[model samples]
Target: MKNGHITQKIGFSALFGCMLITMFFLGAIIYFTVVRGIGAISWGFLTQVPRSGMTEGGVAPAIVGTLYLTAGSILFALPLGLACAIYLCEYSPRGFFVNIIRMSINNLAGVPSVVFGLFGLAVFVKFMKFGISILSGSLTLGILVLPIIISATQEALMAVPHSLREASLALGASKWETIRKIVLPSALPGILTGVILSIGRVAGETAPILFTAATFYSRRYPDSVFSEVMALPYHIYALMTEGTHPEKQTAIAYGCALILMVLVLGVSAIAVYIRQRQRIQNA
Candidate 1:
């Protein structure tokens, strides 16, 4: 018994040490970014167009463009992902076909972002003639995040209590009706959480948008879906790598990074609030 206790203590110490290391890294990143970038963040920085080769003004257009792409991708992906998840989790029988679909989704999730960019360049840009526009980029991001959303939604649906379904059926509810009424509500929190997380990814991704939509220095906000636009990720990349004035551009890059981080964290916080409320209500 004494030996077992010693072993458990050692195991816990190792686990705690790992956790502290991870946390320290995360906190260090946040601290470094905030300390380096906070001075550059201001209202004008958030609301004005860049001037003088992008070293003299704000990133308004980039902010708007990121929001547009994020919204468009979510609009395209959520329903389709939820539908696929429902079919896979509830309707499909356990068999070879289902296994194949599961394998395909897993494979798709493992695909590189740059590969998706190339695919989007071919399919959406050349074949479909979207022409390096917001619509093309959003469609590409939707495809990129589809596997994630579907997997998350499937797991959420599967986590619904089996007894709830049985009870609904016993009460004369059809399978579809039960799913629509009970299972869906229970799973909504998880689905929304997945979607919110996907939004963060869509906002930050540079590769897919680089081929499909982003331009280096657009001053005007995109007027329509067909218009190419600026984005924060591409903006930061261009400033850091290609700008003539390294000092000013680097400051702008750090500022953009800080803004992106804050935006993602804000959205995540809202999602967490909603999820907690849902769980409370369900309980």
Candidate 2:
């Protein structure tokens, strides 16, 4: 009995230590980002248009491009992802083909972002002739975020009680109808959370867009989906890599980092609010 208690205590201590380490790493990252970035953030930095070289510009175009990319990616990914999830959850039989698809999606999620970048460059930029444009980038990011969205949506759907599905069926609802009305409504909060999380991923991505969507310098905002645009991560990367003034570049990078953090935090807050509202409504 004493040995059992000692073993349990040791296990608990190990788990606590692991948790502490994880929190410490996270806190360090947040602290550094905030401390280095806050000084560089201003309305002028946020709103003014960017120019060539680190010393002369703000991230307005990059911000706009990030928004465009994020919006476009969400639009492209959401429908396809939700459809894939619905099909998997509602329509697909628990058979070889379904299993294969599930495995493929899971595998796709593990593929490196750089590989996705190369694929996007080849397919969208070269074969489709979209060039290194926002459209190409959006398509690439859409693909990247799809697996996440699909998995999350599938989990949400699965979480809906089987009884609810049975009730809908007993009401003479078709499978599609049940999914659209009962399953979807119940899973909407989770679905939105997935989307918000995907938005965070899309916002911070550098490699995939590096090959397809971003240019080193863009004096103007993208005029169309097919136009080359500036993006925040790419901007930060460029500044860090190519800028002549180290202080200016570091400052800009910090500022961009700050913006990225705020964007992610804001999206997370909204997702939480949405989930809370959904819980209340469901209750």
Candidate 3:
């Protein structure tokens, strides 16, 4: 018993150390980004267009473009992923084909972002003739995040107690009705958690947009889905690599990074808030 106690204490100490280390790194990144970028957060910096070789101006266009892409991606991915997960978890029979599909989706999550960029270039940009627009980029990002959504939704659906479904049916409720009313509400928190993770990824991705939608510099803001737009990730990349005035562009880049982080964090906070409320109400 003493040996077991000592081992358990050592394990707890190790786990606590790991958690502290993870928090430290995450906090360090946020601190560094905010400290470097806070000076460039004026209203004009956010609301104006670039001028004088993009050395002087705000990132209004890029900000709008990133928002468009993130929203578009979610709009495309969520319903499709949710439907697919529902079919797989609630309707599909256990079999070799289902196992294959599951494995394929798991493998897809591991595929590199750059590979998705290349695929988007070939299929969406070239074949579909989307012409380097927001539509193409959004579709690419939607695909990139589909696996995550599907996996999360599958887990959430499965986590609904079997007894709950049986009880609903015992009340003479149809299968679809029980799933629609009972299962879906119970799983929404987990679904939103997946959405939170996807938002972080979709907002920060540069490569897929680099090939599909983002322009290095645009004189006009995008007015349609077909129009090319300046996005924050590509804007940051361009400021670092393509601009002549390094110091100013670098500052702007950091500012853009801060804004992007804030966008993701803000959305995530709202999702987490909703999820918590849902969990409490359900409890």
The candidate that achieves the highest lDDT relative to the unseen native structure? 1
Give, for candidate 3, the lowest lDDT window spanning 10 residues.
274-283
lDDT of 1 by residue, 190-273 (tens): 888888888888888899998999998988989999999899888889889986999999999889989988988888887788
TM-score (C-alpha) between model 1 and the true structure: 0.91
Please write out the lDDT profile of model 2 over residues 1-283, one tens digit for every residue: 9999999999999999999999999999889989999998888898888765657668899999999999999999999999999999988849899999999999999999999999999999999999999999999999999999999899888878999999999999998899889999988888988899899889989999998999877778889899999998898899888868877788889999889889978887888888788778778
Which of candidates 1 and 3 is the stronger one according to lDDT? 1
CA-lDDT, candidates in order: 0.91, 0.90, 0.90
TM-scores of the models, in the order given: 0.91, 0.91, 0.89
What is the full ranking by lDDT, best candidate first?
Answer: 1, 2, 3
RMSD of each: 2.4, 2.3, 2.8
Name the weakest run of 10 consecutive residues (lDDT summed) in model 1: 274-283
Candidate 1: count of backbone clashes, pairs at least 3 residues apart or interchain:
0
1-283 in candidate 3: lDDT tens per residue?
A: 9999999999999999999999999999999889999998999989998878888889999999998999999999999999989989888848888889889899999999989988989999999999899999999999999998898888878878999899999999998999999999888788888888788789989988888999977767899999989999899899999868999899999999999889888877887787778678778
